[model samples]
Target: MKVVIAIDSFKGSVTSLEGSAAIAAGIRSVYPDAEIISLPVADGGEGTVEALVTASGGRFVSLEVTGPLGQPVAAAYGLLGDGRTAVIEVAAVCGLPLVPEAARNPLHTTTFGVGEMIAGAMRQGVRDFIIGLGGSSTNDAGTGMLQALGYRFLDKDGQDVGRGGAALLDIHSIDAAGALTGLQACRFRIACDVDNPLYGPEGAASIFAPQKGADEEAVRLLDRGLRQWATAAADLTGSDIASVPGAGAAGGLGAAFVGLLGGTLESGIGVALEMIELDRHLEGAQLVITGEGKLDGQTSRGKVPYGVAQLARKRDIPVIALAGSVDHGAEALNDHGITAYFPIVNGPMSLEDAMDPAGTRYRLQATASQLLRLLRAAGRL
Candidate 1:
């Protein structure tokens, strides 16, 4: 029997690799001769860098970079085993969690640290980049990041416009003359899932700014600034960035990557699965196991389990998902390629106890063993 285990991290509890090991151990208890392939996976959000790096035998590079509020923050990026590929999660630098609720205004946040991270990786001879655009606290449309990369956003008087969403409205021109020379030789693959535009009613500010600490008035101001920035960027790059799908993700940082950095935006899970080469490992697997911390309506939207199921479905393999908690909408996953879904919790317990790493591992192992026992009795193992 062959089994492929690819589970995502359980947030504060078990990690992807750890969860996979637990599942594998359970399977081994039932079928000791089973060939188990464990792969670490993430949804291209917070744990992206760690998952990809650990799975690919990569190293992490940590540095102090400017935070969203112009203060110093410790940040890190991943250098893959390939020696040339660097994976960066925007959340690691300017994510909302890094800012307190009282200080979470998008107008004052910046992505300068994201650019600094890229520059730092470039200095290490990394030319290929996989950037995850999620959990950002800025609505600067990448101006702050662009500024750090040498693309100057200037006021009408030709002075530097400075950082944050507040600076977007003051921009009169964009100067690419001083931009990093090596940027032309680099290739960027952006992991993005949202499709909001750059500005307007359905755009970045209007849709996502409120959660980043913007009120109605701040949303209006940020939207106006985004519009102005989009126009200036169009004048410079000659591309209508405002209309691009996912151009509004991560508080308009997606626009900077796709419009200014010449990066291509793709589904976050698709990018993650491609990096891990999930298909290659699924070749002759009889059973595939995948899951995450939770399974809900959002799981079908470019998440780890959904991505794995789709690939397994192509090969006619039975895919089972194991999550810490299963919500009402998780049943919808059955139509999307998941053969079955199971929750690891055995009985009623506190949420904290359920999330305990050792407890999660034990429950996962027990569940897998029982599932395998059922399959064996049914002559399906």
Candidate 2:
């Protein structure tokens, strides 16, 4: 029997590789001579770069770039084994975690560092990009990132506007004469999980700015600013992206790429899986195992387990999902092709105790052994 393990990182507990290894050990205990392929997986969010880099035998390139608050911060991206494809998580440069809770104001943050990262990668001869647009700390309608790429956001005085989302209120026109020429030769694929509009009740400011430290009043102000930016951007690019799904993701970074850069926004997990060639690895696999830190209704929405199970279903392979805990909506996972799911926690224990790496490994192995034994008795193995 051949088994393929493609599990995601257990947040705060283990990396994707670590989780996969623990589960692989479990499967090995049951099927000593079975061929096993362990693949680390992610859904283009927190652990995307590291997971892809590790799975593809790629190298990471780190550099100092401007942070959300205009301070220098270190960031990293991955150069996959293909040598030309670079995976960059936009959050690494200007994510919410980089700023303290007291300083998490979206009005003043910028995605300039993300543009700088892309430019740096371009200089290194990278022609393709996989940009993960989650966990951003900015709401500038991607103006800061555009500025870094040589697109000038001008005010009425023909002078450049300041950085941050608030400055978008003064944006009058865009001077793209100096826009980066390298962009014409590059292809960008943005990974996005949300489908909010650019500016409205369910748009960027209304839906996400609060979490980024905006008050009720600030949300109104930011919404107006986004409206002004969208107007100017549409006038310049001839694209009305304000109502586009996912345009409000990452504080309107999605709109900027779609409207200005002609980038394609797609499912985060699907993009990551395609990059790692998960389909190629699943060929002839008898069983597939995938999971994450939590399994719930949310997991059915472009998450790693859902994505992996979708792939396995196409090949008529059974998928078993493993997680640290299971929530109310976990039963819904069955509709997404998960044959069954198991929570690794053995018994009543504190969250801290269940997350211990050693204990997690032990439980995963024991669970896998028992699962296989049951399958064997049912003549399904």
Candidate 3:
């Protein structure tokens, strides 16, 4: 039997690679002769850089860059096997995790490190970019990133503006005279799942700022600042990015890419699958097994398992999904090309105990073995 395993991370328990290995172990225990191909995958978020880089036989390049707080931080970007494609996760440079809860403040955070990472990749002659826009700690409308790239955000006095979202409120003129010239030669494909706009009730600050440590008053102020920058960005780029879908992602970094760099916003899973060439690996496969930390109605919204199943269905291959726990609405995934779903949890156990790496590995192996045994009994093997 030819089976392809492409599991996502189990989050805090096992990585995608580890999950795939566990499943493969189970398959081997039952059918030692079966051909099992393990592929680690992600939806272009937390594990995006590592997933893409590792799967493509790429390497990571680390450097010091400005953090969300204007402090120096060590950041890394990926160079894929193609040698021309670079994968960058904005979160790596200024993600929320880098900031303590007490210090989280979208108003004062910046995306300068994001720009620095892109520039670093460019310096290596990488012109094709896959930028993951999630888990940000800033709402700067990407001015910080623009600044790092040589775009100048000028106040009424022609003085350069300071970092943070609130700073965008100053009457401004965006000066591109010093912007990186090599930017014109690059192609940027942004990994974005959300569709929030730049400013307004459903915009970045209003919907996401609170989680980034902004209070009600700060949200309002940041929203107002975003509106100001939107108007200015529109005047400078001739594009009303404030209203664009996904323009609010990563605190307006999406706007900077779409409005200024001409990047395309696409589903994170789609971008990830495309980068890994998942379709090519599905050929002639009897079955495809995939999983995530949790499977729910939300999985249908472009998660890794859903993406893998969709592609597998196109080739008429049966797909089985494994999860830590399958929630009520997860049954809905059956209609989305997943032939069956199973949880790795064997029986009663605390959430913490179940998440132990060694325990998870054993459970996954046992589950896969039993699944194969059942298939054999049904004469499907």
Per-residue lDDT of model 1, residues 291-315, tens digit only: 9999999999888999999999999
My TM-score estimates for the predictions, one after another, are 0.98, 0.98, 0.98
List runs of model 3 lying over 4 Å from the truth.
Answer: none
- What tens digits encode model 2's per-residue C-alpha lDDT throughout 236-334? 978898989999999999999989988999999998898788999999998999999999889998899999999999999999999999999989989
Error of 2 at 314 (Å): 1.4
> RMSD in Å for candidate 1, one decimal?
1.1
Error of model 1, residue 363, in angstroms: 1.5
Tell me the TM-score of model 1. 0.98
Off by over 4 Å in 2: none
Ten-residue segment with the worst summed lDDT in candidate 2?
A: 21-30
RMSD of each: 1.1, 1.1, 1.0
> lDDT scores for all predictions?
0.92, 0.91, 0.91
Total backbone collisions, model 3: 0
Per-residue accuracy of model 3 over 317-376 as CA lDDT, tens digit each:
989999999997898889999999999898899989989999888888888889988987
